[model samples]
Target: MAVRSYFLDCASLRDYLQGIWHEVAYDGLNSVVAGALVQLAFGVVKQTESDVFADFPGQVSYETLERIITRGNTQKAEKEFSAARHALVPDDQSQESDEAFVDLKEYMLSDAYRNLVDFIVDYQKNRNGFPTMKMLMHTTPWDPGFDLQQATKEERLEWRRVYTINWLYVTW
Candidate 1:
């Protein structure tokens, strides 16, 4: 909230930029996170809820989470999130319950990314690795130029229609 509001105007983007020096910045997400999450979040900039939800279910399908994480809001969002996100992961046993750190490490590199690692991690953490397959293919970002050849325009349109329904009824 603070970041968006603060930088709502280009005039403020300059102010924040001036405040920072000698810092390596990406997306201006104010914290230094685990490199893996940073990779997922920044690596695949998303345009739809299904794309993000299919990958990261535990995360609220709301930009509020990003806004809170990056420029302000801080722990408040985290606390509210944990309370509401359990449904995303309905599994009785976490596949890596016994090996937490190892799993996080392995998950970051798994083939599951399919081009949207951040989204997948969100699903794994929140949805319990249970988002449907169609959801995955539809929401995951494909390189605009590269994916266009691999996927027909009609197929993309169909996926967009499905996503529109899913977001409208299920997520929204």
Candidate 2:
């Protein structure tokens, strides 16, 4: 079978993000679980489609989406890093730290993110299936020094939702 790619408009993506952000952000476990369940419902839409759909006006390709994501991530990371740097203690009358921090942009755009996107797209388009639990676990990203076994319940849930959000972002 010929492989196909999904495309969506910027407005649609923005609106979807807003909705999910509203639903999932800072409410409670119930809200987060609701978001996860809604994401599963989202999978149903993906599963029902079996055609090579034509691109629509204002719809962006994956490359376009990648650029958009990169731009947004860069801006957010910059603001966050700037805030963090300013919050740090002054060293020898200098506000800026002599020590260098990890590049936020590079970390945000790391291969893990790309691999997760690739895995989802391939599973949906070429295999016409969802990833197994093992595949999902391996592909999902965690903090560099995070220890899953030592994490609290909330931490586990937060980490679990990150991948769900990424899947919904790409596949929705």
Candidate 3:
């Protein structure tokens, strides 16, 4: 199935991610994968041939990006993500940490994340609905670098970089 279909049918964000990876990795003969790979290859070659390429620092090659998206180094990504999680919410504390990424399962099952997902699903079904203050507050824990509890209600409402989800699956 296509990525969009995966999104539509997915029971959770983790499921969606797995479905997307499966589409990219498991079926090289699939037209979607074949066409997308060809297009990306062409774009990479064209960009490489351009004069301004030298201006772009840390430029990633097509092969690198392809490996990242299609077949990530799962063991390494898991280890890195685990270490980050441990650093953020250390063994002694229950307080939320300022980490930007977490294990997919941890993120999906979090109260804040689940609330956001519910809001999105509701919005999709209703087509018109603004999340209440409670819904917004539910996401405060996941806001990186922002301690909502430290701020007053009015200030907390202005929280930036609020993410429904942020995860890293590394290839290298």
Candidate 4:
């Protein structure tokens, strides 16, 4: 389901995420297991080869985007998303630390990582909303756990380097 996927509206994306997260969290997977699954699912995630949604319009619907992101792998994506959130920001203290990425006003000002965050935001703005990590993860297509381990160091780093803080879209 990685090669191609349909864009989605918001409700569908949220449902997808909630469903997957519930399943993964149901068994209380350990941090190690959860983290591994997140890497696996996000790996298969991909952008459309071409912009089929591009046209004279405001933005893609959230439900449409959900399908686009999940690429039919809601289970894997949501599980990993929940795992990553738990790993990266397990508590209030961890959340503070994670903020360091977007904490730097310079990064936000320079737009260094804004493009990536904007991708999801701009689409969600259509319906006056934003997607949570779990929502986005469930909706997005991603790799399996083993492939994440097999990827090159650079590939893994690139995946990890994404601005999760920015994904939160908080402007202070």
Per-prediction TM-score, please?
Answer: 0.18, 0.28, 0.21, 0.23
RMSD of 4: 18.9
Off by over 4 Å in 2: 1-84, 88-94, 104-108, 125-129, 132-171
Model 3 misplaced regions, further than 4 Å: 1-116, 124-126, 140-143, 146-162, 165-172
Scored by TM-score, the top model is 2
Taken over the whole model, the C-alpha lDDT of each candidate is 0.39, 0.49, 0.43, 0.41
**What is the alpha-carbon lDDT for the whole of candidate 3?**
0.43
Q: Model 4, 17: alpha-carbon shift in Å?
A: 6.2
> Candidate 3 residues 1-172, lDDT tens each?
2221322232243454456557768755475765665566556445543423344347634333323423455344444442222233556565644555434333323334443556566456545454445454544455567777788754543343244422210110
Question: Which 10-residue window in model 4 sums to the lowest lDDT?
Answer: 99-108
Over 60-82, each residue of candidate 2 has an lDDT whose tens digit, in order, gives 34444444444646555445332
The model with the greater TM-score, 1 or 2, is 2
**CA lDDT, candidate 2, residue 121:** 64
Ranking by TM-score: 2, 4, 3, 1
Q: Indicate the worst ten consecutive residues by lDDT in candidate 2.
A: 1-10
> Candidate 1 lDDT, tens digit per residue, 72-169?
55344334322112222466643432311222111121222222444444456546544456655665453344454566756655454444434433
**Candidate 4 residue-pair clash tally:** 25
Model 1, stretches more than 4 Å misplaced?
A: 1-126, 144-172
